[model samples]
Target chain A: MSIKLTYFDLRGRAEVIRYLLKYGGIEFQDVRITIVPWGNLKSTVPFGQLPIYEEHGKVSNQTIAITRYLAKKIKLAGNNNWEDLELDALVDTTSDLLEKVVNFYHERDTERREQLKRMVLAETIPFYLSRFEAIAEKNFGFLAFGRLTWADFFFTTTIDMLDAMTGMNVLKNYPHLQGVVSNVTDLAVIKEWREKDKSSVVLANDAK
Target chain B: MSIKLTYFDLRGRAEVIRYLLKYGGIEFQDVRITIVPWGNLKSTVPFGQLPIYEEHGKVSNQTIAITRYLAKKIKLAGNNNWEDLELDALVDTTSDLLEKVVNFYHERDTERREQLKRMVLAETIPFYLSRFEAIAEKNFGFLAFGRLTWADFFFTTTIDMLDAMTGMNVLKNYPHLQGVVSNVTDLAVIKEWREKDKSSVVLANDAK
Candidate 1:
C-alpha cells in the first residue's frame, strides 16, 4: 500500500513531510483537505490534529514524527549507526522552534508579537541558523555530512515556514541558511513535483 | 573516546539522556557543568542550547535529539520497524507539552501565574496526559506495544520535572499516568540513579 499523508491542503504541518518526499524522490498519496471540508475530516485524525501518516496499515501522528517516519522510509535519515538518530533529533529542533513561532503567531498580541519575532530573530533563528550554517560549512553542503539528512530538509522547511507565516525574510540575515533553503528547494525532483501542485500551502511569509 | 553530554548539570534537558544512559546501563562521562559559565560554552552549542551529545567524535545539540541518539544506542527504541519512530514521536509530543509548561512558567507574571496554571491544568496537561494514558492502556503497560520506548521515560521525566518545579501534582488527576510514573521510578536503575544525584535544579515560580 502507498503511504498516505492526511492534512489540510495547507502546508501548515504536512508541508515539510511532503517536501521531504519530493526531495527524496519518494511518491506518496498526498491527501489534502479543503478548508470547507476540514470540519468533517477533523475527527478522523488522532488527537484531532492533522499531519497524520499511514503506511502499510500502520498509523502515526505528530508532524515531526510523521516527517521522521517518512525520512526513515525514504532513507533520507542518515548513513548508519547513530547518524539517523542525530538527523532525527536535528529535525526535531526545527519543529521545536516552529512550535514557538506558531504560538507567537496565534497567542501573542500586536504589542508582544514584534517582540516575540524579534526574540526569535535574535535568539532562536540565529542559534539554529548559525549552527546549520556551521554544519554546512563543515560538510561543505550537507547538514550532517556527505548525505542530505532529514535535518537539511527540516531546516529549509523551518526557514520556509517562518517566511511563509510572518512575511518576514528570516534568512536574509543569514545567507548560509538561505543557501541551504535554496539548495533543498532547487532539487530537481522537488522542483518538478512542487510545480505540479501549486497548492503546497506556502505560508503567507513564504510568499516573498 | 567516551561519550560526553554537556548541559547545565541539571535534569531539565539533560536528564532524559542521562536517564537513558542509566536505563540502558551505558557508561559515559557526564561532563557536568559546575557553573553555566556561558561565556566559555555559549559558542560551542548549536542554537546556544544544551544537552549536546558527542559520540564517534561528532557533536549534536538538542535534548530530544540526544535522547533519541541514546535511545538508539541502548536499543530501547522498540522491537523493530515503525515502532521506534512512533515511540519517539509520542515522546516528542509529551515533551512538547512539557515545553509549554516551561514557557508558561517563564512568560507569566505573578498576577497571571495561577490563571495560567489553571489553563494548563484544564488544557495542555490533561490533553496530553489523558492521551498518553490511553496509549499506555491500549499497549497494556507501555506507551508503545510490548516494549518500553523513550515515550515512557519522557512521560516519567515530565512528571518528575513538574513535581519538582510546580509542586502542583500534575499527575494526580491522571491515575494511569501516575501509575506509569510510579512504575518507571520504581526501576532499580532509575531508583538508584535518582538516589545518587537527587539535587536537581528546580525553577521556582519566583525564579524569574
Candidate 2:
C-alpha cells in the first residue's frame, strides 16, 4: 500500500490514526503487529517505535504528529491558527490523561498500584475530566471549538483505553465529555468502520 | 503586558517560547516566577500549570502548542502542512528524550536512579541522539527540514534542561546535534537575549 500505518495490535497508541482514517474516508493500510518479537520492525523504524505513518514509503513517527497531518489532509484541522492551537492544546491535555492512566496500570507492586489507582480515580481523573467537561459544555459538545475538529476524533479514540485502564466508565460523571465521544462515534462512517472486520486483535472494549 | 509567558525561573519548558519570540523579533513580557508557593498564580492559570502564553488577558497552555502558535505567527513554521508534520514530529521526539531524562532524574531510590542513569547514558540517550544526529546531518544542521524551522528552536531550547538532567555533556559525541544547538543559540538575537539582564533564578549552567 502507498499509505500505511503500522502499530501494535491493541489500541494503545495508534487508535487515533485509525479512527481519523475512517472518519476522513481515507483508504490506507492499517497494519497491526500482534506478535511479541518485533525484531526487525523495532530496529528498522525511527526511534524504534510503532504508530509510524508511511506515505508512499516515506515514514514519520510520533502519533500526534501523524494524526495532525491526517487531520489537516482530511480538512479536520482548525479553521485558523488560533483554533488549531486550541485543538493542539486540548489534544495534549488528553495525552496528559493518557500518561497518568499508563503509569497507574504499569505499576508492578500491588500496594503501590492500588494506591495509584485511588489517586488517579479520585484526583487526577476528576481534575482533567471536570475541566474537559466544562470546555465541552462551552464548546457546544466539542472539545476545543464550537465546531468539529480533530481533537474530538483524538479524544474519543483515546477514551476507550482510558475506560479499560480506570476499570470504570471514567466518563460517568462528565456528560459533556460523553457528548464529545458520541459526536464522533455517531457519525455514519465511524459507526460503519467499527462494524466491519476491523481486525483480529481489536481491543475487547473498543467494540462499543 | 499585552503579550506574556509565565513559567518557573529555570529554562526548562518555556525556553522555546522565549527563544522564538526573540528570534521572531517580537516584544513582550517574560514573567518568571521564582518563589515557592506560587499560590495565586498557580490557581489562576489553565491546567494550573506554568509556561502559559497570554495575549492581553487571554491565555493558552501546553508548551509545544504555545510554541507552535507562536511559530506560525513568527513565520517559523514549515512551508507546507507536510513540513509542519515533520517539524512537529521532530519536536515531539525531543520531548520523548526529555521524558526519559525526566524519569531518570525523578527516580528517588538511589540504586534505581543510578541504574537508570547508567541505562540512559549507555542506551536510551544514544538510541535517540544517534537518530537525531543523522537527521540533523541530513537536514543540514536542522532537525526536520533543511531550513530554520521551529524544531531547531525547540531542540536547542530543550538541550539546556537535558544537559542539567543528564549531568554531563549529552551532545558531546554528536557533532551534528551540537551544530543544531549552535545554529539556534549562535543567532545574534538569542546570544543577546542570553547576555542581557537575564532572570534572577536562571539555572547555574545556563549562562554558557
Q: Candidate 2 has which clashing residue pairs, if any?
A: none
lDDT of each: 0.73, 0.84
TM-scores, chain B, all models? 0.89, 0.92
For residues B118-163, could you state the per-residue lDDT of candidate 1 as single tens digits?
7877787877777778877777667777456777787887777777
Q: Mind giving the per-residue lDDT tens digits that candidate 2 earns over A1-208?
A: 5889898776668878988888778889988776556676698888998889999878899999999999999988988888888889989989988888777787766887899899999899899888889899999999876788899988987787788777689898899999999999899988887787355333443342
Give the DockQ (C-alpha) for candidate 1: 0.59
Instruction: Give the true-contact fraction for every prediction, in order.
Output: 0.60, 0.78
Position A149, candidate 1: lDDT: 70
Model 2 interface CAPRI class: medium
Work out how many backbone clashes candidate 1 has.
Answer: 7
Q: Looking at model 1, give its docking quality level.
A: medium
Per-residue lDDT, model 1, residue B139, is 72
